[model samples]
Target: MGQFKVIVVGAGPVGLVLAIALQKSGIDFVVVEQRKQVPPPTAFGIFLWPHILRIFHQLGLYEDMQSIGQVMTKLENRSSTGEHLEISNSFELLEFAHGYPTMLFDRRTFAEVLMKNLKRSDQLVKTNKKVTNITTRKDGVTVDFADGTSERGSIVVGADGVWSTVRDFMRERAPPGLFSEGPNPFIAPYQGLFFRVPRPESLKPGQTVYVHQPNKQLMALVTATEAHMTTYERVPDVSERTYFSPNKVTDEDVKYWFDVPVNEQITFKDLWDDKVMGGKVNHDEGVIPWWHWDRLVLVGDSVHKVECSMSPFRGAGARCGIEGVISLVNKLNRTLNSNPDPSRQDLSRAFTAYQVEREPAARLWVHVSRLDIDLYTSKAGPASKAATFADGRTIPIVANSPVLDILPFPDEKEGVVPWRRHPKADGQSKDVKARL
Candidate 1:
C-alpha cells in the first residue's frame, strides 16, 4: 500500500474540518475515528463567531447554516432579581472583525452539514478504527489501531478528543508519566439535567434567559428553534449513599429542585422519560494540560475541558481546530518548498513552529474558559455579586490591542499568501469605468 501523506485521528468537528481543508489544499490525508457512527441527541448548541462563519462560507456552508440556525442579534446578562446588568449586540461589534454575523446552531446539525459535504469524498474518513499506538521512525510515523491494523504516514494529527492516544504516545517521550491536577476548587459532582423543551412562553424569542438562585443553583434557558434548558446544582459528596446518582438524575430529583407539582405535562419524568432524554451527570473540576513531544498535537476538549459558562460562544473550539490545521499545514508547506532533501532537523523545526504558534493561544483560552466558570458558579457573596456585575459589562481590558487579534496575512513578495480576495469581487471592479 502507498504511504499516506497524513493521518488525522478523530472524526469530530475539528478533525472533519481539518480533513476538508487538507483536501481543498490538494493534500492526501485520511481521518480515523473510533466511533461507529456520528453521535445523536443533538449533544448541545454551538455559537459560531465571525471567523468560524467565514470558514463555513469558504466551504459553501454559510447559506446552508443561515437557512437552519438562528442569527443571535443581542446578548443580555442579568441578575436573578431581573436587573439587566449588561447588554451588547455582537452583530454590531464583531461584524467589523469578521464579515459575517454570529450564529447559533445545534451541534448535530452542524456535524451533519460537515458530513454532507464530506460524503462527496469517499474514503476521506474511516470510522470504527481506533488508534491504539503511534511510533515515530526516521522517515515518518506508524499508527496501530485496536483491530491490529497499522498505517504509516509522514505526519499524524491528533484531532482526537481529550484522551487522545496520539498525545499519549508523544507524552511517553517526555518525563515519564507527568500529569497535572484539576484547576477548580473541588465541588461535589454537578448533576445536570438537559432537555429540549417546547419554547417556554415566559422566555422571549432570540434571547437567553438565565435564572440564578444564590448558592442554590443556576438554570439557563437558551432560545434556539426550541428552548434548550439545563439545570445544574452541586452535590456535596458523590458517595453511594447520596440520594441522587451522578450517572443519571431521575425525574424525582428534578421535582425536588424546581419545587413544582409533578403533572403529566410539567414533570421532569415526562421530559427525560424518552430514551433520548436523561442520563447521569458526571463530576469534573479541572482543565487538564495538553502538550506533547515531536510531531503530535492536541486540540479542542482534548486539550481542556470545563463546565459550560454563560459565554454563549462555541466557536472557540472551531477556532482551535483552524489554528492547529493552519499551523501544521503552513509548516509542512514551508519545509516541502525550501528543502529538496529535508532532514530530521527540518521536520523538527516545523513541529517546533507549530507548538510555539499554537500553545500560548490554547493555554490562554483554557484560562479564560475556566475563569468564566469560576465567576458564574461562585456562591452568594460579595465575590459572587462582583462577578454578576462584571458579567454584564465589557471592560476595555486591552487599551492598545485586542486580547485576540487575527494575524496579518503572510507577505505576498515572499511567495506566501494565507488569504486571497474573492475573484468575482476583483473582476467586478474591472467592469467599472475609469475615473476622470
Candidate 2:
C-alpha cells in the first residue's frame, strides 16, 4: 500500500461503500466510525429508487438486499378525508432507466448487508475510531482520533453525518466563496411521530398508504413484512416540543388529533417497539449548510438532512452514498490515475468537480422534500386539496431529470462488487416477485 492513504470518517453505509470502491481501485484507505457496535431493532426503512438499486446491483448486494427488503411497486396518495387522489406505479418510471426494480427495506438490514460485505476486507474499514480533528497540509492529511491515535492519509473523506467535525475543519481552512451558500430557508412548519405496529392482514406487502386528513395533516403506513407495519403522522410544528422532548409523551399530546378515543393502554413504546420509524422526534434539529471544502468532502445526512415527507420516495442518505462514491471515484480516476502523488492541486480539482456535480442535486432534493411536507400540511378542504394538487406541478419530478444520469459514474453496464461474494441468496429472485 506504500505511503499513500485515504481516510474515510463514519462507518455508515456511505463511508464504508466509499472505502470499498477505493480499495477496488487499488487505493489504500481506512474507515473511522464512532459507534462501537451496530444498533438493534432497525430504526427506519429506505425506499431505494431504481437508480440507487442499480448501484446496489452493481455492488452485487442486490440479491442480499432482496432477501431482506420488499420491492415497492406502487405509490398511493389519499386525502385525509379518505379520497384517493393519485396513484402511480414507480416501477413504470424505473423501466425507462433499466429493468432494475425499486425497493423498500429496513435500514438496519440494509446496513448489515453493506457491513458484511465490508468485513471481508480486514485491511480496510476500521470501526469505533471517532475522529476528533483533521488537518491537511502540503504533503498529506492527518486524522486525529478521540482515543489519542492519529493516521496520515493522502486525502480525508467526511462521510460523518450532519454536524461533521471534518466539514467544520475544512470550512476554517477553505478560502472564502469556495463553498455553496447556506441551505434554503424552511418553507413551512411541520413535525411528526413514527409508530410501529403489527401489520394488519388487509395491508398488502409492498403497498404504501398515504392519507391526507381534513385537518391539513398526513398519515402514512408502509408494509414491510407480514408482521411489521410502520406508521407516521404529520402534526403542527407548535406541538413539536411535546413529542420531541425526551420527557415522557402524554396521551393529551396526541388525544385531540385522533378520531377515535385515545388508547390509554398504548404507550409510545407500544407504537414504535416492534416497528422501525423516525420523525422530527428522532432526528437532530438543524440544516446541513455545506458539502465540500478543499481536501475534505461530506456525504449523506452529514451534508443534507431530508424531511420525512420525501422519505418514501427518496433514499436520502443512501442516495448520498451512491453519489459520493461515484463522484469520488470519478475524481480519483481522473486525478490520481497517472501519478500516485496526491498534490494540493489534484485534491482541489477532485473536490471541485465533486461539489459541482453533487450540490445541485442535493439542493433539489431538499426543495422537493420541503414541498412534499408543505402539501401534506396544508389546510384540508376541497379547495385546499385542489390547490395542493395544482401545486404539485412545482415539485420537480427528479425521476425524469437528467441529474439522475449524473449518478452511476463510468457508465458501466454491470454494477461494481465492493467485496467478495457471500453465499448466494437462495430463492431470493422468487421472493422478489412474490413481494412485488
Candidate 3:
C-alpha cells in the first residue's frame, strides 16, 4: 500500500463520495468537516441523474439509494394563470436511454446512504474540525484546523463549497501569476426561496412540476413523502447582483410570493403554511477556469456551481462535483500503482490531466444551465420543448460518463443509447475504447 494519504475537506456528498472511492481503491484518506455533523440536516430534495446513478451502481450502493428514493418519471408544465401548458416524459425518456431512473430524495438521506456504506466511516470521518490553514511542502501537505490540530497528508482535496477557505489559501500561497481568475468566480444572477411540505394526496409520486411567470419561475418535485418547491425570482438587469447570506424567509418576502400560483389547484401560500423547512439564497453561476495548483486541488462547489434551483435538469452542481472527485481518484490510483510515493511533479501532472478531462464538461453544464434559467425567467419559448433528452445533448453526455478504472462496471441491459465502454471495464478492447 502507498504510504501517502489524502486529506479531504468538507464532508458533503462530494467529500463522502471521494472517501468511498478512495477506500475501494485501497488508498489512505481522512475527511474533515467544519459542521458539527456530516451531511447537516436539510429538507431540500436532491436529484441524481442517470449518469451519477451508474456510478452508485458500480459502488454497490444503487439498491440502497433506490430503497429510500422515488424514481421521477414525468414533469408537468403550467402557467401562473393556472393553465396546464404541457406534460412531458423527459425523465421517462432519459431512463429508457440510459437504463437508470432519475432518483429523488431528501438531501440528508442521500448523504446518510453514502456515510453508512463506508466500511471505516467512524475512523475516516472527523466532524467539528474546521481547516484554518494549509501548508504544502516538497514531500507533503499539512492542514491546520481551528481546534489547534493538524493533519499531514500527501495532498489536500478541497471539497468545501463555493466560499471555500482552502481556495482562499491557494490564492494566498500561489506564485503571483499561477491564477488569473478574480476573487469572485461566480455571480448572483437570481435569488431563490425554497421550502418543503407534506406531499398532497392529489399529486402522484415522482411527479415534478414547473410554473413559469412573468419575471419569476417555480419548480416543485413530489417524492413519496414530501413535496419540495423552489421559486426563482429574477434580479433586474439594473439591480446589483450580490451574494446574499442565507437566512430564514421574512414575512414580507413570503407575503410577496404568497399569492403566486404553483398550479391551478395550489398557491405558494398553501404550501408555505405547511412548510417543514424553508430558507432563501442567491443562485451563483459560473465555473473556475483552473481547478488545481501544486499539492492543493479543488472539487465540487469549491470550484464550480450551477445552483441546483436554477436548472430544469437538476443536480448539475452535485453531479459535476462528484464526477470531478471520481476522475481525481482514478488518476491518483493510476499514479500510485506505478510509484508508491509520487513526486510533486508526478502529482502535478496527474492533477493537470484531471482538470483537462473534467473541466470542459463542467463548463458546458454551466452554460447549459444558464440558458435553462434564462429561458425560464424570460418565459420566451415552449417550456416543454427542451424537456426531452432521448435525442438531445443529455443522451451523449450520459453515454460518455466515466467510471472507476480499477473496478468492473455493473451490468445492465443495453438501453436506447449504449454506454461508451471503458477499456479497463469488463476487459473491453482498446480499439473500442479509442472509438469511445
Candidate 4:
C-alpha cells in the first residue's frame, strides 16, 4: 500500500546500514525483517578490519562505536598447551597502517547501536513481515509479505542473509549460465557451534585469542560483559550429506569439540556449564555464485559466506553486508539518475554492475579464508608448520604480510579501504555516509 524507491528485505546489520545510507542519500526506502521481536542475546563478537573501520568512520559511527567497543591492541596465537606460536603488537601496526585499531564489540551492542541510529520520525523497519514473494512488473517490483501485506518499490535488495529468499527468486529467474552449475555454492563444508558466557578471568577484556589443533580449534574473545567461543572441526562426511539446514544442536552433540584446554587452570566445559548464555548453534559457510537478477539482488551472507577467522566475525558477515549495500547504492545513484524512467533491462545492468564490483573482493576473501582456517586448524603440515612459526618469522614473509592488500589481490586499496566514494558519488556529499 506504500510506495518507495528501495525496499530492503532484512533488518540485520547490512539491511539497516543500507536503510541509513539510503535515507542520508535522500532516497525513500523501507526495511522488512522476519523477526517479531528483538532476538535474544548472542555469544557473538566482531573483530572489524581496517577497511571496515574506515567505512565506520565514513558513516560517523566510528566514535560512537569506539565508546561502546573495545580497541583490540594485540594478536596472539597459542597451542592447546598454552605455548605461544605467534605473538605480535597488533594494535600499533593496525593503527599505524590503517589509522584505526581493530575493534572488539559484542554483537548485541553493535546491533543496538545500528538500530538506535536508524530511529527517526518514520518507522523504517517493519518486523514480523516475512517476505514470501517478489514480483517484477513494467513499473517496478512488488514484494508480498507472509502477513498478506505488500509494497511497491523501484528496487528490492535481498539482505535476507545466507539462506536468502530473494536469492531463490533471482536464481529462478536467472538467465542460462548466469550463476554456477552445482550444489549450494553459498554453504561451505565446515559447521560450527558457538555461545557467549561471563568473561573469564584468564582472558583479558578486549583481547582475542585462538588455541589451535590440527583437527579442531578453540577460539575465544572477551567483551565488557561476556566472552565468546566457537569450534570448527573437520567433518569428512559433509560432501555426501547436507548439514546446511538449521539443527537444534544440544551441548552434548558438540561437547567433544569444546572439551579442550583453555589454560592450565580452566577447561572449556567448565565455562560452558557455568555461564553459557545462548544455545550452541551451527551455521554453514561458502561464497555464492550470483548476487543479482533484474529488480532483485542479494547482500551479506546471502551472496557470500566464509570462515575468515576462527570466530564469528571471522566470517566477516558484518563488513561484507555493509559493503554490498554501499556498492549497490552507488551504482543505483548513476543508473537511476540517468534514467528516471528506468526499464527492467536498465535495472538488470545496474544489478550486474553492483555484482561486478563486490564479487571479486568477496570471492577473494572467501578463498583466503579457506587458507585462514587451514592455518588455524593445522596440527602438522607445511602450511601448519609455517603458520606456527614464532611471530611467523620462519615462514614466507607472506604469512605476516598485509592480507587485505596481498592475498585478496586486486584490492582497490591494499590493507585498507581508506575512502568510500558511494555517498558522495550518489551526490549526498554534505557528509559522505556509509556503515557496518
Q: For each candidate, what is the lDDT? A: 0.53, 0.55, 0.79, 0.64
Candidate 1 wrong stretches, greater than 4 Å: 1-4, 39-41, 76-92, 177-193, 201-205, 215-224, 231-247, 252-256, 259-290, 306-310, 313-315, 339-344, 381-436
Backbone clashes per model, in order? 3, 7, 0, 4
Please write out the lDDT profile of model 2 over residues 221-278, one tens digit for every residue: 3455532332234444331222233324444555534442112232223444444343
Span of ten consecutive residues with least summed lDDT in model 1? 397-406
Between prediction 2 and prediction 4, the one with superior lDDT is 4
Of 2 and 3, the candidate ahead on TM-score is 3
What is the model-wide C-alpha lDDT for candidate 1? Answer: 0.53
- Candidate order (lDDT): 3, 4, 2, 1
Candidate 3 residue-wise lDDT, 8-107, digit = tens: 9999889999999888777789999998987886757778888888888887888899999999978888777677888878788788888898888788
Each candidate structure's TM-score, on Cα atoms with residue i matched to residue i, is 0.72, 0.75, 0.92, 0.83
Candidate 1 TM-score versus the reference = 0.72
Alpha carbon deviation, residue 316, candidate 3 (Å): 0.4
Q: After superposition, how far is residue 273 of candidate 1 from its true place, in Å?
A: 7.6
Per-residue CA lDDT of model 1 for 1-436, tens digit only, reads 2323778888877788777666544456788888787534453466655556655565556678777677666555545444545555644455543445666677688778777777454477777888878887777778898989887776778888645667667666656545433222223345565555555444455665444444333333345445555655655643231221322655565664453212213333333443243344433333344444555656554554333342453235555555566556556555654653345677678767766766665555545543554555556521444543443232111111111111222221111112233222222121121110
